[model samples]
Every structure is written in structure tokens, then in C-alpha cells.
Target chain A: MVPLSWYLALSAVLFTLGAVGVFLKRNIISMLLCLELMLNAANLAFIAFSSFFGQVEGQLFVFLVMTVAAAEAGVGLAIVIAVFRNRETLDVDESNLLKL
Target chain B: MTFEQILFILFAGIVVGGAASVLLQRNPLYSAFSLITTFVGLACLYVTLKAQFLGVVQIVVYAGAIMMLFVFVIMLLNIRDEDTAVDPNRFLVYLTIPLGAILLGALLYVVTKVNLAQPTGDEGGTVERIGTNLLTKYLLPFEATSVLILMAVVGALHLAKREKE
Candidate 1:
């Protein structure tokens, strides 16, 4: 079997990358994409632990996470559409009416 | 290296590479496709970890349904390649590097300290078992999730609907 720590390490790397991407990217949709990456990274860790311990709870948690992710995407994309309709641009920097 | 090690490396490469591509791409559409690649790679990893049901669900729900939703929104909005907007807070960019590095280091340190027991050899992720668990042990959360999805649907419809002129 491949060492479990390897999977955990991979999860950490992916999560860090997603965090960096969230900061570096200027577009709202891209930021959301990075958010999905972070979510998946956590899911990877859950699956790794679940498999190592042979527990059904981890997989079930993953299932619930996927459900939350799906809901988040639907609502988030709709918000993105509404923003684009108003601003006609995808850049987060440009959508700064709320910023002082 | 063992076959499992080799497969792990391959899938891990795909996952990391796809994630990097999502970060580097200028177009949101391209990033969406790259995210799909990462999802598929993770699904393969799940399969190797003996969570076959989750592996399939990862592909069908994530790579298929969620990605299609993203792509359709991209097309509907007619989003072009993002222009390099002048950032008001460039300091955050520099700050992220060290923060991310520290986070990764801390996570790795924690992971290495854990010494879990060997695999229990029980298949905890078969469809039948998961279904039974969902209905019995996890009934409350399962029902709550359905309500959550319904709320999401209503919220999305309300948010995206065009106002009457």
C-alpha cells in the first residue's frame, strides 16, 4: 500500500496551492474555482484517513461535503452572473462598490 | 517502486499539475477545464484508496454536474480573458507566499506525527453499506442536506432572475 502520509502531504500541497490561487487570481470565478480546489483537497484527506482506518464516517462526510459544494456552486455562480450583469467585468478588483 | 506507489505518483502529478494550470490560466473557462482534470485525478486516487463509491460520485457529481454548471455560466456571461487589473493591495500577494508556506509546513509536521493503525480490511465504502448508514446512523444530516439543496435552488433562482422592466 502507498503510505498514507504521502496522501496527506499531497493534500497539504493542494490546499496551499488553492490558498495562493485565491489570493493571486483577480477574477471572482477563478477565486471560486480555487475554493473548489481547497474543498477537494480536504476531501482527499478525509478519504485517506477513512481508508486507513476503515471507517465509513469519513466517506459519509465526504458525501455531505460534495452536497455542500454543489449547493455552493449553484448559489455562487448565480451571484457571479448577477455581478457580471451589473458590472460587465469579471475582475474582483473592479467590483469594489462595497470597498471604501 | 510498487505498482500502487507508481499509480499514486501518476494521479498525484495530474492533480497538482491541473491545480497549477487553474492558477496560471488567464481565462476562467480554461480554469474550469483544469479543475475538472484535478477532480478526475482525485477520483482515481479515491478508487485506489478503496472508496470506489466515492470515486464514482466524485466524477459524476463534481467533474460532470458541477463543471457543466460552471461552463454554462461562463458561456452565458460571455466572459473574456481577464485583463490585468491594477491591484489596490499588492502587499496581500507577497503576504500569501509566506502564509501558504507556513501552512504547508505546519500541516506536514502534523501529518508525520500521526501513527495510525493498519487498514482494518473492512470495506466501509460500498454503496449498500453507505446507503444503509445514511438511512440509519446519518438520517438527520441526510434529511437536512435535502432541505439545504432546496434552499440553494430557490436562492439561485431568486438571485439570477432578471427584474421586470
Candidate 2:
């Protein structure tokens, strides 16, 4: 049987990749994609733990998280589109009008 | 190794490999395609973890809906070949190596310390059990999630609508 630690390790690696992507990628859309990756990594961990403990709570939590993630994606992409319309560029460095 | 182990290995490879490609690919379209593979691998992993409902939801919400939105936006944006770039700073590029190593080290340490006792594998982790838990123990999260969805709808509309000139 595959060990739970293995799953956790994989989740951690994926999460790190996503986090790094968020920090390094300049494109707004790519950054949003990275955020989704991070959310999925967390969901993977939660389900792994729930199954390891033989409880259904974690699965239910995953469902809740999925709902939130979908909503976040919608709002985030709309913002990206709106910003692109005005700025004519999705580069993160160019989106500094709001920076204080 | 058994069939489950082999499957786990394959899915793990797909998830990690696809994610790396997503980060490394120069074309945004290619990155989006790679993200789909990552999502599919994750959905399979969810199934192996006995969260059948969650697995289906992952596929439906992430692979089916969210990814489509991503692709749509990419196409709508019409990002040309001249738009992309690899970051130029050597210092920043090198920093990722050590940072990633440290994060991986911390994760490995925590994983080693935890004692994850395997399930007795008797009771099926059924959808009925999940439904009951959502109504009972997880009612608050369930309600909060609906609110989150509502907020998302409003926020998306606000974002998409043109500001009053």
C-alpha cells in the first residue's frame, strides 16, 4: 500500500511549485493559475488525511473548498480581463497604478 | 509493488511533471494545457484517497469549468509571441533553488515526525457518510461556502462591468 507520507510529500512539492509561480511569474493570468494549483495541492492533503483517518469530514471540507475555489477563479479572471482592457498589458510589473 | 502502488506512482509523476511543465513552458497556452494534466492527476489522487465525491467535484469544478475559463481568457487576450519573457535577474533566479530546497526540507521533516496510522479499511467511506457530516458537523462551512459563491458572483459582475464614466 502507498504510504500517506508519500501523498503529503507530493502535495507539498506541488504547493511549493505553485507558490513559486505566484512569486515569480509576471503574467496576471499565470499567477491566477498558480493560485488554483496551490488550492488543489491543499485539497489533496486534506483528502489524504481524511482517508488516512477513515473520516468523512475532510471530504466534506474538500467540497466546501472547491466551491470557494470556483468562485475565486471567476472573480479573479474577471478582474484580469478588466485590467487588461484598461492597461493593454497583463504584466505584473506594469500594474503598479494601485501601489502605494 | 501492487497495482495501486503503480497507479499512485504514475499519477504522482503526472501531477509533478505537468506542474513543472506549466511553470517552465514559455507559451501561456502550453502552460494552461499542462495545468489540465495536473488537475486530472489530482482528481485521480482524490479517488485513491477514498473521497469519491470530492474526486468528481475536482474534475467538474477544476478541469471542466475553471480550466475552460482560463483557456477562454487566454484566447480572448490574444497574447502574441512577443509578449512572453524569462525573468532576467540571476540573483532572483538562484534564490528559488534555495527557497525551494528549504521548503522541501521543512515538509520532509514534518512528514517524518507525524505518525499516520493506516485505516482499518473496513467501513466504506461512503457518500451518505459525507452528506450526513456536512449537515451535522460541517454545517457552518457548508453555509459559509454558499456565501462565498454569492460573493464571487457579485464580485465577478462588478469586475466585469464597466465603471461609470
Q: Give the candidate number with the greatest TM-score.
A: 1
- Each candidate's DockQ: 0.73, 0.70
Q: Candidate 1 regions off by >4 Å?
A: B82-89
TM-scores of chain A across candidates: 0.97, 0.96
On lDDT, the leading prediction is: 1
Point out the worst 10-residue segment of candidate 1 chain A by lDDT: A89-98
Writing each residue's lDDT as its tens digit, candidate 1 over B1-165 gives: 999999999999999999999998888889999999999999999999989999999999999999999999987877665343326567888888799889989999998887776466587589998999999999999999999999999999999999889
Runs in model 2 lying further than 4 Å from the true structure: B122-125
**Per-model TM values vs. the true structure:** 0.96, 0.93
The candidate that achieves the highest DockQ relative to the unseen native structure:
1
lDDT of 2 at A47: 88
| Model 2 C-alpha lDDT per residue in residues B83-111, reported as the tens digit of each score | 55656763656677788788878987897
